[model samples]
Each structure stands twice: as structure tokens, then as C-alpha cells.
Target: MTEDFQEIVETFEFLDDWEDRYRHVIDMGKTMPPLDETLRVPATKVDGCASQVWIVPHIEGNGPEAVFTFQGESDAMIVRGLIAILSALFNNVTVQQVVDTDAAAAFAQLGLDQHLSAQRSNGLRAMIVRIQSLAQNKLASDS
Candidate 1:
């Protein structure tokens, strides 16, 4: 998962210009795993995305070290890549880590805002909101 982020950063670094970067971003999107159809429900759908998106989060075990798993899908390839990037970072993290982590900062560290379109940036925010909300809910339930 960390490797994925490194690869993204490397790809971003390799591009000489925005046009090349856009193509690289699209290539990154192509690598995202396909979303499961059965999980696409209104409750799972992430709002604020230009395309249809669904996210499912599952917490296993207890305490601050417990693992959180996530599965997601999006109609747009770029969005799917965004989901993939997020899942790689957030999945398997503890609930406390999820709550404490700054997703936007991580994206910034990867230069996502500079490389992605405004719509894609909004979609990424929507995805982060959904993941964070799920983590918060799980923590509440666990408490």
C-alpha cells in the first residue's frame, strides 16, 4: 500500500508537464480494482462526487489497533483511482488512526491537488468524508 503511494509520487515526478500528468493520472485510474456490484446501495453511496460512488467499511477486532477494511467503487476511472489511493492508505488502520489521520494532508503530500482536476479533487474529498464518517460511527458504536 505504501508502495502504491510511492509509485504515484514517482509517476507524478516523472511527468514533464500537466498534459503528461493527466495521462499518468488516467493510467493510475486504470489500475484500480473493480468494485463489487452488490455493495452499491444508497446508504453506501458517497455524495458530492460527480460520478456514482459507493463505499463500504468494516472494522475487525477491538481497541485502537483494530483493522478497518474498506471497499469502494466509482463510475469514473479517475474516481476509482482516488478510491484505490484512499483504500491503500486507510484500510487496515485502527479506528483511532482513522480519526486522527489527515487525509487531505496525505493527498497534498502526494501533490494530488496540483495533478488532478477540480471535479476529481471534490470526489476525493467526498470519499475521505465517507471514510472518516464510517470510522467515527464505528468508534461511537465500539464505545
Candidate 2:
């Protein structure tokens, strides 16, 4: 659904090593528009991130079929890039899609699992958990 996501996959597939991939990710983060200051709040802050990360969900449509989008930011460049990847995958999609997505598998298919440090891996997993939780919460509220 995201053009950049496809581009990213293609680009990563082209790159031979993790070095270039890391740079691409950092570059993606550098280009990401800054998050609104007001959106960063205690309630929105994701726990277990190595950096200060905030995620907010926006929804459209109605009832159980409503679609959701996420906006997020992080103090760390790597973390921000991680957020971008998640956004690319989950943004502007149905809550059920978010719940069904195999985020870890997607990352692994990109060879990110082997490249990520323990802290980064944990942070990434936390982000996925948070996103899924948001979807689940919306489903509950919409019921």
C-alpha cells in the first residue's frame, strides 16, 4: 500500500550488506517530517524503547470496518527509521489488518533480525506490540 515500502524492499534487496541498509534506514529517518510537539505525551509514549518514542493512531470510516493510520517520532535516528517502516506497513489500513500482520516475519524477510542489536530488537518488538494493542483497543471500542 505504501510506495516507499516497496521501494525500500527493492532497495534492500539490491544492497549487498547491512551497512548500506543501515544508512538507507537512517536516511529515511532523516527525511521523515518531524512529529507535532503536541502529539508527544506521556500516554502516547511507548515503553521499552531505547529512545523516547511516541505513537498516535488516527482512524476513519465507521464501526468495525474503520481504517487506522499511525504517526510517530523518536529521538534516535535508528528508532525513527524503525517507526517509518512500521508506518509504511500499517498506516492507512484496517484495524484487522494490523492485528493480522506478521510484523516480525516482515522484518526478518528484510534480514533485519540478524542486524538489529538486542536493544533495538526489543524496541522494535515493543513498537509492534503497541501497534497491535492500539488495533485491539479500537476493535473493543467499536464493538
Worst lDDT 10-window in candidate 2: 1-10
Best by lDDT: 2
Candidate 1 C-alpha lDDT tens digits along 1-143? 35556676677678768677666656666776776777898988999999999998888987666688888888887677777778767887788888787888878866777777788788888888889888888788777
| lDDT by residue (tens digit), candidate 2, 1-143 | 45656677788999988999999888888888898999999989999988899999898866657798988999999999889888888887898888888888888767899999999999999999999999988888888
RMSD of each: 2.1, 1.4
Best by TM-score: 2
Global lDDT scores for all candidate models: 0.78, 0.87
> Model 1, poorest ten-residue lDDT window?
1-10
List candidate 2 segments past 4 Å from native: 1-4
**After best superposition, candidate 1 residue 88: deviation in angstroms?**
2.0
Clashing pairs in 2: none
